[model samples]
Target chain A: MKFLKLSMSATAFAAAMAASTSAMAEEYKMVILQSLTGGAAFIGKNVADGAAMAADELNANGFFGEGNSLVYEVADDATDRTQTLSLITRLAADEDVLIVMGPTSGSVALAGANVANEREFPVITTTNSMEVIENGPWSFILTQPADVTIPYIADFTAQTLGAKNCAIIGVKDNEAYVALQRKYEDLIQAQGVNLASVDGVALADSDFSALATKIATSEQDCVFIGTPAAQGANLVIQLRQAGLDPSIPILGHNAFASPTFIEKGGAAVENVYLMGAWVPGGYDDFSSAFSTNFEAKTGIPADEWHAVGYSGMQVIANAIKDAVAAGAVTREGVRDALGTQTDIPVVMGEGTYSYDEHRVPHFGMKVLQVKDGAFAVVGE
Target chain B: MLSQQILNGLVTGSVYALFSLGFTLIFGVQKLLNFAHGATFMAGAFIAYYCTISGLPFLLAIGFSMVATGVIAILVDLIAFRSLRKRGNAEFPALVSSIGVDLILVSIAQQVSKTQVLNFPFGTFPVKFYTFMGLRISLLQLVILATVAVLVALLIFYLKKTTFGRQVRAVATNERAAALLGVNAQSVYLQTFFIAGALAGLAGVLIGLLFNSMQFLMGEPYMLRAFVVVVIGGLGSVPGAIVASLMLGVMQSLTVAYLPSGLTDAIIFALLFVVLLIRPNGLFGDANAVAGGTRQ
Candidate 1:
């Protein structure tokens, strides 16, 4: 009889503990859609990592208070546009999921934004297109747009580098790359640099021998290659091999500011001017602390993509926090809060974030260079 | 500058020739398209990349990659083509099967690579230049030129001088007749596929090292180019493929240099269309290819 009574008491105690734990808080999740397995995987993986880390940071700091915590549910679209649409629809149909953070690829992000607008779901994207903003107010972009950053890069290339004549080369098929090259062309020309060759190559162009032959024989003071890291590095190496003087500066877009660039280019990337925004010890105290804590937590080094992703999440979570405080944490409530939230402190650029009157996220910019085989801040 | 561009085109066309040789060979022997040729090409690069990173010597890595891709090509034929060939009306079904096989190989590589672009290690091939007669040429470029030249010569010699080559030609002429004459048609088909795959494999390695970028989808672009090369070179002619490849390469390079951007493909396809309209059998192809022929 005594043994039976002890067993009954233990069962009741276990049940009570379960109930207490379950009643402690409500968990809210926003989908962290990304291209974890494709051409953009480098960006997607880092972005997802930073966003998830931001969620963990919020929960640890008691920013969500005692009643709720955010969950950044991660998903991969494999860098496919069609898969991105399906993911957005499925995530939006979840009544509990109030927002979607990314489909990091520019083209895939644009497709997801269209669906998000039709579904009236709020989305924060990392794509570099102004077209996504045209999709509607329901979709928001958090990346430092090229229009704002490329001018600084172009000016730096022309003024600081003393490049009197500039040549441009990039992928003609990609709209973002074409826009970047055009912006550089216009701004560099505005700085009194005569244009030499505004050459465009195919997206799948691996053989730079033909293009490099043209550039090496051309009379340009410097050349701005607007391809991504590996391609850009290979081009630089080939151009050098093709007899372009090593003293001639190679200016590139922000995509060149990556560890992969350093790894792939090695000695070739030395002194190549690149556009970038984040580095652990390169930014403000907030960023420094965040980077330190971030490194301590995740064991992965912080990068530009990590900063963009963390800032993007803070923008989303701050709105969610406000909704929670107002006792109306619904999808529309979060969307309304996101529209009003501004000037939130972040770990990007000059250490703050906000959507401008045009509904585009704003951040500071910088120019980086490969100094002694490592990334170093050169200009802004 | 024009000469340099032509030189660049020749190097590129050499790889194009390497890529297209096998594609045309399969068509010559089997009269079926192997859409998975690109996948095998990609597989070659991936295999070479992995082998190199694992501390294999560069030449050894190239050899291993070629052999592995050859086996992969044979497997493709066995799985995707053999049954279709048995069914007698294999053209449509074989095309679909090859596509399915290509997708499977691509998907597997994607999963293995996790979609990261790969590169050969620095100094895998020495980075040295040779300047002569106001022209700058890298040692690697010379190596590529020499390698392609030797391989093409050897292939020609083998085709003209070997007994297996005779069987291959007979099979290409008429499979049933070759089989009735004890030519071992299956063996010929396998041998042709093996040779084609090995060539594509080497092309993949050279491109991966040349471009310093290798990814799962690297072969897709070449597949489209292969169609252009084969159709323009004449469906079943090796020498024609080489000439057409170099022509296409030089034309593409010059267009990129002189004309507006994005017209490279248009010019190339236009040339192909003109070739088709005028010389239906290709520049080097015999009239028998267009007239009622074997295999079809």
Candidate 2:
């Protein structure tokens, strides 16, 4: 009778252990997908930072709810499309991650969208291009589209600045610049401002004296520069050297909104207007908090890309919280929660999120001008 | 528009001439197309920039850069090319060996200077405007043109008048015969490379100043253009290289100013193709010379 009683206890203990182990296995796993290495590291590092911070904040605050310990996994895509897809597949199948954030570049994000859609994992792309969300269902962009930023710039330049004629200069053979130039030209024309001329310069060409001279001699009131920081900085210096006054007003695309632009352009970049998704120095709380924490953590200035990255992470964390609250911790459930997200308070400062029509954020941009060698919010 | 384009071409063509003359001289004397020529040019620019940045006077920097490049060229020949000659390798093997040296030198440069464009600290050289009838030219272009002309004239005088230059010409024409006549062909070859490297180095310093940006990879573009100039100008002819450089530069400039930028490179290549079709051995090529044997 004693032996039977002992056997009954042993059986009960084994059953209880099995039940608890099975329950533990059902907990949600999150993956932070990013390009940690390569040419895009400048942007990728920030995105990774933002996601990690959000994860840390969420976990520490018990945002995943009581008794639900979230497991976070980070994967490097190396800014390669093939590797990005491979990483997504591995993370989805092996880790069984319910949600993911980023595959940084717009082009890489587009490729990641297809895999995310197939696996039912919601991926919040941090790139600003509209192409990321045009076809994918499980993808949502955290950055504002060119269409929104371009139109805003047109109105700002025409009405606020009272610019009558503008010259548009874009980098030759770059598809992104080509698309931006087309939108800019259309918007400028729509604003009743004369589109004086459109010039295409090669990326490697340092001699912009000829182009600058032509622009100076033209009837244009302002010049719109659409190139990366390196070429753009060179053009600005050359333009001024060739006797084109900075007082005439120079407007640039979002490409000119990086710290590299300021660092490279130096004093020459002063008084230039840039229309970007986030207003640098405008997000008082976010900027201050990020600067203090980021400098302490990484010993580097948290540029605009870092802000976008942090915002992307916040969005993902919110969706994860909503997913768990609704009792849908699976990939499909997390994706559904992210898809239904509305007005997520991102670090980019209070942006609305809607993937109803497409997986794109319809965030408005703030105009910032380089004043006294630093970006400051102008009359918006 | 056409005239402006031609002027642009002339400037570029002058650069091509400077590059090709060095390449042809090396090929003619050594029978080896020194692929490391580009690296020598790159080294020259780096040395010049380093010297200038370190507070050396501008002229001294140029002189130091040239001398440094010439020394490096001789070292390259001794360490890399000398082994192949000692081993009695075929012409192809010697050429291949030079390419290996080129790879090593280029990699060393790339590692030393991370792959970013270093801007040369060029304040404006005195700017003067010269008007010739309806055409206007800048002082910078005039300086470049005058320098090239003077260098070419000096090169011709040295080759015709100097005993060492005559020995160089003799070795280039017939290495075996020159050596049999106690002309010290090896020394002639070494001196030829030294002079050729100095010219290439000077060109690099000039180009770096002109573009205001110097990178490790900058040499490749000029090297390729030099090859085209050499092919079109006729191999082993310094005068031919100069003439072809001018023509090529004019063609490129015209294409850039008038035609769509996309078509510019295509048009330049098309002109090169036309030249090849008309004169397979090049404009100044010897009538009886075997095709593809000029360098050998």
Candidate 3:
């Protein structure tokens, strides 16, 4: 009887050891493909912060599949298109990565999207451009489309704020701004607003004194600046300095939502209108929670890019959970699950999501005003 | 529209002149294009930003930035150009080395600063406006114009009146002859680089203050504009560079105002093409200047 008891004890110990080994073997890995170096690094670092935070949350909450925990791998593309393609290709081929997340710029996102489609790996893009979502059902945009945001600015300036005469200043030959200019011009004219002037400034333009002078002389009640935060803020400050203030409302597109805009524009930024997908200080509980947690984790206030990155990871994480629940780890299963998602809570400044047939989640936008150097959501 | 265009041209032209003066000096003395010159300008702007943000006085920040950039220029020559010169490498090889240095410096600057645009403190200077004949000009423009004028006059006086200036001219004309005539060509080259770099550094600070934002890649546009001015004004000619810079700036401003902004650069390039056709040696090239004359 003693010998039999001892044998049973040994067998039980072996069984426990096997269970531990199997659990360790089932650890799931994910790759964050992004540009973490070079000029885009500041924005990319924030994106990385959001992605990492989501990964940590999932791991801590045991939100992964029944047999799987999560591990993250980061690949820096350095904002190079060719490097991004190569990196995505290698990451997709890695049998360990259950999913892949970024490649921040719109152009890089488009490239990664093509590779993800072939490999059947899911990619969630944080970029605002629509071209990344045009071709594939596997791809998702965490940010609202520029088309949606740009027109919203136009409508806000025209019908809502009642600015009849508007001048548009955009970056010359920039694909994103050029696309936005077309949409904005069409939308503004449809609202019966007189498009006083559409001025194109070169991307390398350093001085706005000339543009400001022209705007001061023109019969416009508002000016819409479609450029990055740096150029936009510079234009605003110069316009104000040139004595064109209190005469026209300076409305900015999504670019103005960046913290750099506030830091650069300072006091001049007050009363400037900006259209964005999410505003941090608002009633959105999910965004509030995410912002607080993000700041705690990264030790940096969350920016728009961070919010988008977090949302991208959330979308992927949700789809991963749904896929595992359905006992389908294949790419087709993940794609189907992501496509059918409805009202999934996004951690972005914009809450909730609804995906169309293309599996692209549509998160609408809101307009925010810069008051006392912070963003406040104006009434819709 | 015409007045606005001209005003734009003048502001842009002033910046161009600032950039080309450095380029002309380096080209005149060293007989090297110094592709890394743009990186020097970019670095200077970033250093200026760092200083201003760190609570250094604005004027002190400008001076420190220039001095720091001058040191970097000396280092560039010592590490990259001096070695090539010592080895007696072909001019093409030296040019290629400069390009390599350019890449390294640009990469380092971008890595350190990232891509964010940093703004100088507002109200650092008064934003007064002056009107002449119904054309409004900002205090910033007047400052830039005055600064460039003083710098150009100083450069001219230095070249014509100072012993070091004569040594630079002698080395530029013939390094071997200057070396034989008790002039240290290497030292002359070093001084030229220092002066040129300091000028670029000053331009960077001026541009950052005037534009209200500075980026790591800001130097590329100025570099291109300076190149165009140098080609049009006649290479190695300081006075010629100033004239060409102002002309190009006015041309760009006028084009942006009168024509669509998209066509402004195209118009400028077209004008360059016309100038090249009319005078292949450039507008201010000497009588003995040869077409496609190689820098010695």
Q: Alpha-carbon interface RMSD of model 1?
A: 2.0
lDDT of 2 by residue, B69-167 (tens): 888888878877877776665478877877777777766765555434455554425545575764556677777778887887887788778888788
- Interface RMSD measured for model 2: 4.4
Q: Candidate order by TM-score, highest to lowest?
A: 1, 3, 2
| Candidate 2 per-residue C-alpha lDDT over A189-245 given as tens digits, one digit per residue, 9 for 90 to 100 | 888889877778755455554466556556778999987655676778656654676
Local error of candidate 1 at residue B253 (angstroms):
2.0
Q: Clashing pairs in model 3?
A: none
Off by over 4 Å in 1: A1-11, A36-81, A280-303, A343-347, B286-296
The numbered model that scores best in lDDT is 1
What stretches of model 3 exceed 4 Å from their correct place?
A: A1-25, A36-46, A60-62, A65-69, A118-121, A202-204, A280-285, A292-300, A330-333, B286-296
lDDT of 1 by residue, A1-380 (tens): 99999999999999998889769888877898887765577678778888888888888887787656887689997778899999999988898898988888668889989999999998887777788889997988777667887887888877778889887888786656777788888888888998888878755667778778888888888989998676788888788778887878898887776566777788877899888767544467888887787667765456677777888888888999888888878888898888777889888766778777778777777788889888788743
Q: Rate the local accuracy (lDDT) of all candidates.
A: 0.83, 0.71, 0.75
| TM-score for each of the candidates | 0.91, 0.70, 0.89
Q: Of 2 and 3, which scores higher on lDDT?
A: 3
Question: How much of the true contact map at the interface does candidate 3 reproduce, as a fraction?
Answer: 0.49
**Which digits, one per residue and each the tens of the lDDT, describe model 3 over residues B239-284?**
7788899999887766655566578667777877887889875688
DockQ (CA atoms), all models: 0.59, 0.14, 0.42
Cα error, candidate 2, residue B68 (Å): 5.5
Q: Encode model 3's per-residue lDDT on A12-110: one tens digit a residue.
A: 999999898776645556787776764455456567767778777877787774446668887787767788888878877886676777777657778
Ranking the candidates on DockQ from highest down gives 1, 3, 2
